[model samples]
Target: MSSAIAQLLDGKALSQRIQTHLIQQIQQLEPQKGRPPGLAVLMVGDNPASAAYVRNKERACTNVGIASFGKHFPTKTTQAELEQTIQALNEDDRVDGILVQLPLPPHLDAVALLNQIHPDKDADGLHPVNMGRLLRGEPGLRSCTPAGVMWMLQEYGINPKGKHAVVVGRSILVGKPQSLMLLEANATVTIAHSQTADLAAITRTADILIPAVGRPGLITADMVKPGAAVIDVGMNRVTEPDGKSRLVGDVDYDSVQAIAGYLTPVPGGVGPMTVAMLLKNTIESYERRI
Candidate 1:
């Protein structure tokens, strides 16, 4: 496989362009709404990773001219307390989007809290209402990461129609929604997971392969089809022999790059696109509220 056979999907560049367009849209819409679109990101615990993600989202909201109503809570915060906060934000006219950062403390019921967010303001698109809408192929806010993957595919002119798409994860956040999106685009979709038998066998059948399972390098070059479009949504942090940590995706990038026709790099890939879609969802909710 020659290097010329592969091309980077470049989600970071596309995400910046998305932010610019969002900024212009916000500026034009602010006068009529009397306020810029606002997004509330509720994060619990001192998990450094979740804190970093919240900060990135807030910064992106600021750059896109959207207001942030973010909140940070202690890991020991009660479920009822968090529920009350969500209810207040749901009714707050100033806020257009609401998101709960994932992997909440073990004591909390993440699904119950996510269910409480109003469907229209469900920015993360995990609420049962939003998920139902997605299942029905209705017009509603989409899951940020999966939506970003679809947006990237469109931007790169890689249509899923008539192609075979294998999504290797079953989480509501990325894999399930990702497979649904590909099906909506007329692709034949198959979903495999970490527990699936002969995972590599299914992977080789895909024209489009998206893996969101957290394990690093789960998708090796031998598992992929030549010229397949590989969009990696997994993010894992590992310590190197030098005692330094770095981020990596599910796909074995260095080897797979030589075979895939289109691929997204780990740090600059789906990560940035997820934040961009969060801003886009906020703006969409803002327009509908008016």
Candidate 2:
């Protein structure tokens, strides 16, 4: 095969297109419904990264005419207080979607707080009910990142059916649900984690490779099949020799791009799609209410 740089999946462009469409849909519905769709994002502490992410989500909501019911809590916020807040949002008719920012304060029980959200308002789709629906291939809100990956594949006409897909990382947030989605698309799926031995051997056999582990340079060029589609879901910030930090993915993009047939860029790939999917989920919940 002639070697060439891999084609980009271009999640950023696709996300923008999806958002534009969503804006029109919401506008047409808001006139009759009397209020725009609403999303409640609850964040705790002052993690710089989490703060930046919350801001992005809220900004996206504003851009699409969705109401933002964002609540920011101090680092010392208690689990009981957060639970009560979720209970309140659950009862609020104005709120259609509720999301609790991850990496909450140590004293707070994140899972318990998430469980308190009504399944219909679980905007992040991390609630157990939604996950179960995904496993059974039923209609329900889906986990945002995994759903975004599936949408990207469909947008590019990358059919996973009858292909071997190897997913690195088994976290519930991305890896596990991603594997399930791939399976639903008829791809033969293999999940590799820290305990898995001979990781490169498994990856090399894949027609589609997804590396979600947040380690820089984990998947080298040699580990990829020459013509495989490589989706890099890992987002890591590493300092350069000059002490300046920059974002990178799990795959070594420079080397892998030459070997792989298709590849996703670090910052512009899955990140924007995740946000786009979040907005989509919120609007879906809103539609259910009306």
Candidate 3:
């Protein structure tokens, strides 16, 4: 392992800067726009982690001068009822963005509900229209998590152009979008998943190794290329020896930090940037709507 410790990518600080900029922008425009930009986040179940994430998003919205119209429902909320609620929010003139919290109850038709959201108001950028826009390299709302990852990279001058980037995970939310974004930045990207043979071999070749597999400590020092930028997008709740839980990312920070040239930590890294991007998408949508 290299003795040089990786340069920390302070996502919390970058997110705070974005929040400050958004606050100024909103303050300057809200008066002529007749109201602040509004975002409505719809939550379906009582999943503790999901609840905490929603609360964080809502609080970020408030900090940036955006209005929040969030609602929580029991796990038993019906699909039709949720669809109706989305339709109502879609037509609400005051609302510029709408996002449904993920991991909905098993019975709920998550995809259909996501499709029901109007493209312009799809805050999470999970709607088909936005995803299509992203795929086509057209301007539209971006998926928050992936966008956060990109923003953090650019902030630190880690250009993806002409680099070999390996993304471990295929989920539409992070890994796929992340690869596309990196490709858009002119990076040659490779995606590895559970079935990929010799995962470490592929990861070791990456100039930028991003692991969003949600498996704590999946990527260790040996898996990383020396001087590579390791962006850990994974969020897993792992229990310590004392039975206390903590958030961790896919890369083994203790080991990888000493090997990688650049690294983003678990709790304060991509997580804060995700919320910052959510607020940004809302503000952008509001601008277009007004």
Candidate 4:
């Protein structure tokens, strides 16, 4: 008897393709009398992880030929000052998209600060208006992660219509919007959270299983249905064998790979596609504004 491992979903390749498409689209656009499409990223505090994320985003912008405006504040900065900076970015004509890194200093209100970005310039797609548009089935910017997930499915030729999708987290940033995006693709969606009873039983019924719960090894082999498409969105840090920290996902890759028909890896999976989609959204916002 032979056992076959699941096919790996390559997010890095897909992200590069998406970026290439964006670069071409951007080059073909009419050059206006204003500056290039600009993405303004606001970072508060000096969290190493947050700083790395912001720096990666800026690099991605540069790679795609999009202009970037970055604002970094010390950990002790007041909420009022941050809001003022956001307000200025919101009013700047050269700025096409505004993104505020998550997990701001405890004193700052992330929701309120995100709300300050105009809907048209919300690159992260977390603004109230953008979320509302997603819920209402209206035309607007889709959340980067959700959009990237959809892009992967399409690139891999996985049709969600009439499929059962189980989303293992209900986070606003990943789970909720992701479930909705799958539903938009005509898939029956079930969103599970910490309170859900018998999560393993629920997950086993899915044709597409997505784990975004932020807990490593939460989804094991028995939990995933055979031939199911698995997407691991968690990026939890865990101690490695070398006594160092490493990033892993919610799904137990070794165990689940034996059962799943398709699987996305941790760091190399959904991570790269996110920035690519952000560039896509920035270009989309630019075209719309122009």
Candidate 5:
């Protein structure tokens, strides 16, 4: 007997659709003589991952006709300097969205810098105002990864309403925000983290399981409920047998796929959707201004 294979959620293609839509909106906004929609990306330090992520965002901005303004601060930059940069971007009429890449230097106060961005221009959606809006069910830009995860579920026709959703990892970016979004969709949401006991037992009860924990292969086959839709948001790089590194998610893809009704692959799933949604948010910000 052959094992059932799970259907893949193609984030790359979905992102293309979002980018195309943004392009059309940008064309419509071009006739205006005033400031065009702009995204200011703040990179603090030389982290390879952050740099790569910023480059991808810049490329997405170009593809969607949004102007990109970038500020690179040395790793030794003071928190005040970062705050000043954000304030400048906030006051810049041409700038519509501001993103501060994560894993900032130890000396820098990430939250303080993030809070300095104008609430409306907080594209990464990490500001307290935006987070509050999400909690209150008020319309605002959501955290990119969580927003992408929700879009993936919606695009795949997996309505969370009345479903049991278990989200592992309670980080503000992915888990907590995602749980809120799921709750907004009327899903019974449970958030489990590193401290949660009997993690497998909690996960097995989920109709929709989302794992954003950075740990590789945290969610195994036994933890996955049969026919559940699993979205693995982790992208940890691990060395393979041949000694080359490969991107792997929290869920053990090979083991979980056999039991899952649908699954999103690492590197090709939530990652692409993030930038895509950023463009969407930028365009939406422009529309709101108009």
Candidate 6:
């Protein structure tokens, strides 16, 4: 085995490159479009983490010349109210994308509200229509996190064709879509979840391993194959022994880096890519209008 540290999949730099390109594209199209592309991010409650994420998204929109039509609702906001707002945004001619921030109030039904978003404007790509389109390999908006992972792979020339790709997690949000994308790229995909027996055995067999189960330190060094590409999609905040909090991914970065040929860092890896893909989806929706 080659004694070299795994190459980092630097998502932050790539995300910036994409945003810069998008800025130029928007500048060129604004004249004919008459207005900047608009994205409506509807956020509910005061969840600190969600608030921070919303702020980051809106800031990214501003940087890329996209108009932010964001709305902040109180914790007690009812489901009916949010649904009405989504309907209005759907009808709004200026808005090209609409995303409802997740982990909504306990009383609100997130799935029902997501279903109400018009398929074309579903920027998060969680609507059943988009998911269905993905399953059929048809052209449609895709879930941002999974799409970002695919882009990262392609950027580094890591083709999945004819490889054994093991994805740990079966959530509709990331795992399912990610597996489908890999399959589309001609990889033999295996999805392992919480109930999968001998998880390490399955993971060690992967040429490309992706863990999106949102648990920290779940994939240890022994679980990864030597020289295999490891992608960490999990984002978990854990407190260190020194009483400091930090973000970590599913794979043990230090250990995996030594074993795998390529690995993505937690905060700088999949997180930035996720936001970048969201912006890309919104831009695509805007272009479709023209």
When 3 and 6 are scored with lDDT, the better candidate is: 6
Model 5 per-residue lDDT tens digits across residues 25-144: 788886883656899999989998899999999988987888999888888888877887888888987888999999998887788888888889988888899999999999998899
List residue ranges in candidate 5 displaced over 4 A: 33-35
Q: Write the per-residue lDDT of candidate 2 for residues 1-290, one digit (tens) a residue.
A: 55688899999999999999999999888877889999999999999889999999999999998999999999998888889999999999889999999988788888888899999999988999999999999999999999999999899888999999999999989999999999999999999999999999999999999999999999999899998999999999999999999999999999999999899998999999999999999999999899
Candidate 6: stretches off by over 4 Å: none
lDDT of 1 by residue, 1-290 (tens): 56665799998999999999999999899999998899999999999999999999998988888889999999999999999999999999999999999889999999999999999999998888888889999999999999999999999999999999999999989988888899999999999986799999999999999999999998999999999999999899999999999999999999999899999999999999999999999999999998
lDDT of each: 0.93, 0.94, 0.93, 0.91, 0.90, 0.95
Per-model TM-score on C-alpha atoms: 0.98, 0.98, 0.99, 0.97, 0.97, 0.98
| CA displacement after TM-score superposition, residue 19 of candidate 6 (Å) | 0.7
The local lDDT score (0 to 100) that residue 95 gets in candidate 2 is: 93
- lDDT for model 4, please: 0.91
lDDT of 4 by residue, 126-228 (tens): 9889999999999999899988999999989999999999999999999999998999999999999999999999999999998898999999998988999
Superposed by TM-score, candidate 6 places the C-alpha of residue 86 at a distance from the truth, in angstroms, of 0.4
TM-score of 3: 0.99
RMSD of 1: 0.9
Q: For residues 1-290, could you state the per-residue lDDT of candidate 3 as single tens digits? A: 55889999999999999999999999888988999999999998899999999999999988888999999999998998998999999999999999999989999988999999999998889888899999999999999999999999899999999999999999988989999999999999999999999999999999999999899999998999999999999999999999999999998999998889999999899999999999999999999987
For model 3 the local lDDT of residue 204 reads: 99
RMSD for all candidates, in order, please.
0.9, 0.9, 0.8, 1.2, 1.2, 0.9
Task: Please identify model 1 stretches exceeding 4 Å from their true place.
Answer: 3-5
Where model 2 places Cα greater than 4 Å from the true spot, the runs are none
Model 6: per-residue Cα lDDT over 1-290, one tens digit each: 55789999999999999999999989888898999999999999999889989999999999999999999999999988998999999999999999999888899999999999999999999999999999999999999999999999999989999999999999988999999999999999999999999999999999999999989999999999999999999999899999999999999998889899999998999899999999999999999998
